[model samples]
Target: KEIMQWIDSENSKAKVQSSIHNFTDMCWKKCVTKDITSNMLDTTESNCMTNCLQRFLDTNINVVKLIQAAQK
Candidate 1:
């Protein structure tokens, strides 16, 4: 039982990491339109990525809440 719980915990961590990677890739492509000349992101690109990440998180939270409400 302990091993099963540990496996579940690891799987959850992996899923979260995968979600973060996917979100980063999607946001980067959507926000970064110009060529990558420098290591730092410009103001517009930075704001775009921030907004994109916020929107994704907000949407995810809302979905989870709705599912929880339905289950209850």
Candidate 2:
């Protein structure tokens, strides 16, 4: 039982890490408009990254709201 619990805990951690990685990759792809020419990001690229994160979070919120409404 303890071994199974350990496995479950590890699996949950892995899933969360994978999700974070996926989100970061998706956001970067959506935001980065040009090739990385230098170490510092340009203004547009920076703003795009911020916008991407905001939209992503907004979408998650909307989905959760829809689910809650459906449950009720």
Candidate 3:
């Protein structure tokens, strides 16, 4: 039982991590739509990437808070 619980916890953690990565990727593309290559090309892209991460994190926090409130 304990081992199963541990596995479930790890699974949840992995899912959350993947979700964050996906959100980051999506926002990066939106913020850097002009990139001609598979990689970020310049300081503008670098800045966009940073902004993408910030937006993802901020939005995730708000969504989580709403979920918690609804659960109450």
Instruction: For each candidate, give its TM-score against the true structure.
Output: 0.75, 0.65, 0.57
Runs in model 3 lying further than 4 Å from the true structure? 35-40, 66-72
After superposition on all CA atoms, how large is the RMSD of candidate 3? 3.4
- How many clashes show up in model 3? 0
**Residues 1-72, model 3: lDDT tens digits:** 999999999999999999888977786677767837765357877787778888778998999999999999
Q: Rank all candidate structures by their lDDT, best first, as comma-separated numbers.
A: 1, 2, 3
Off by over 4 Å in 1: 61-72
User: For every model in order, what is the number of clashing pairs?
Assistant: 0, 0, 0
- Give the Cα lDDT of each candidate: 0.96, 0.86, 0.83
Q: Which 10-residue window in model 2 sums to the lowest lDDT?
A: 27-36
Q: By summed lDDT, which 10 consecutive residues of candidate 1 come out lowest?
A: 33-42
After TM-score superposition, the amount by which residue 2's alpha carbon in candidate 3 deviates from its true location, in angstroms, is 4.7
TM-score of 3: 0.57
Please list all clashing residue pairs in model 1, or write none if there are none.
Answer: none
lDDT of 1 at 33: 88
Per-residue lDDT of candidate 2, residues 1-72 (tens digit): 999999999999999999778877887888776878889868887888778777888999999999999999
Residue 51, model 1: Cα distance from true site in angstroms: 1.2
Ranking the candidates on TM-score from highest down gives 1, 2, 3
